[model samples]
Target: DIDRKHIHIVSVRVDETGKKISDSFEKKRSDAIRKELEKKYSLLPAEKQRQPENLPLKRVDYKAGDVKKQVSNVAKVVMKSYRFQSLNEYRAVLSIYGVTVEEVKGEVRGKAYNGLVYSALDRKGEKVGNPFKASLIGKTAGYDALQKRIAFSKQSMKEKAVYNRSRNIISTLLANKPDRKVFEKELAKNGISVLFRENDDKRIYGVTFIDHQEKTVFNGSRLGKEFSANVFHELFNRNGRQDSSGIDYEKQFHINNQDYQPEQESTAEAIAGIFSMEQHGDDYEELAFTNRMKRRKKKRKGFGL
Candidate 1:
């Protein structure tokens, strides 16, 4: 999270003459100045180190059979809730994130296996969603490696999509200077910022536009598999409970024989089901309320109107 008010903006301008300065005698002068500044900064005292706060961590141990059973249970619950016409739709969404499903088998002929009937593997051949198989991946070096690979793959895909869209917009804008200015102005009006521009060589490079006051609303780190499951559970299982005062609160749906409270149940299940799931506990609602109050206070404090 960033403090939007503390953001600083720096602007750099480059023109034909400025470019010539870099190519000529100014290069040596700039390099010497940079070295001098670096030497001066190196003599400064080190900053005080802050003590690291310890976080609670837990390890889950389950076998392949246990994972199979959990997946089957979760699948059954999802199917019952969702109005999917076919199993294909369910499988398709899972496959989008490179999840592979396989059926478990019995060693004895004609006898059914009590263990996991299906297992899921990620793109890196490591178990992703299946808790039973996750232990294997974690024990090996595959878990961390696969996670990084998947994250990078997804980010690359998103960047490519954004780049393609930007290219089309840029091409359209280049048709006319007045239209280009209009496009930039429209983007500014909407607070849709950019961060790069072209140089005299026609090569697009360097930061162009940045929204100093805009705090990033969502972080990819918070949208991992566990978070997805929590969101899914909240959206699907939980019903909005209306209080006497007419305020609605999200309540988790519970089945028979569960000891966890609504929010705890959903969060625990989500954590147990997904890989790298962090325990956010029941603080989401409280945090939201606190943030709302803070925003209200800031609004009152900063804006007299």
Candidate 2:
């Protein structure tokens, strides 16, 4: 406290080392860690920069204008074949069958008396011909005999009605087509058998006829390539041949190996099973055994066979 006014201090000095100890240690530690990482991972070294490979270029030559012109030409040709007339006036031909007539004899020489004639009616059941003339004829062959003959004739006519009607329909449909023979051939190819021809003077344009349980008619020309293609496709399909429908004839299943089997699988598997049985007898026997077991199980479960 007494020497406060004249207090003195001494400073201490240290010599500089080659590098700071802490800094040297940090540098060495960093290098050691880098070397350890390199030894453990062994990553690929950096490579020289390179240019990317060039890909081949392509060019389209189709011009929009040229495509439009070509499409227009095809459209014009197709349009020319289409009919534009009103369809309301289209007529079909139908045949009247089982038609029988009766005439009465006159008391005077060389003159036949006109009397009521009875004929079998159409599906509508309307009595055909004059009743009085029918009665006179009925008198000649008794009512029972006449009725029997009429019934037989009616049955025969009905049997032929489908065929007759189909012919009439086809003829009427082809009336304006101008390619009747071609159309007929096409229909025949499709299994349509023409029965009778219709009168041309009636100006009928379309006809309908019976094809077994089906009614088919030709009404107009095929609309386009697609329609023609479809017709041919159906024809070939039904005839067991390969048409342009992309169906492979060789791949289908069949009961007999000689028959056409399209490459498509059948839902019932009947054809495939039959074919397999024919080709692989042992496999077929095993399959049959399995099927029989399944049927027995189903029967036990109260399912209908």
lDDT (10s digit) by residue, model 2, range 1-106:
1111434544333337544345457657866775677668984322222222211111111232232222222222211221112111001111111122333446
Question: 128, model 2: CA deviation in Å?
Answer: 20
lDDT, candidates in the order shown? 0.31, 0.30
Query: Where is model 1 more than 4 Å wrong at Cα?
Result: 1-66, 69-133, 137-143, 160-293
Name the TM-score of candidate 1: 0.21
Best by lDDT: 1
TM-score for predicted model 2 compared with the true structure: 0.16
For candidate 2, which ten residues in a row score worst on lDDT? 272-281
The best candidate in terms of TM-score: 1
Q: Which segments of model 2 are wrong by more than 4 Å?
A: 1-178, 194-202, 212-305
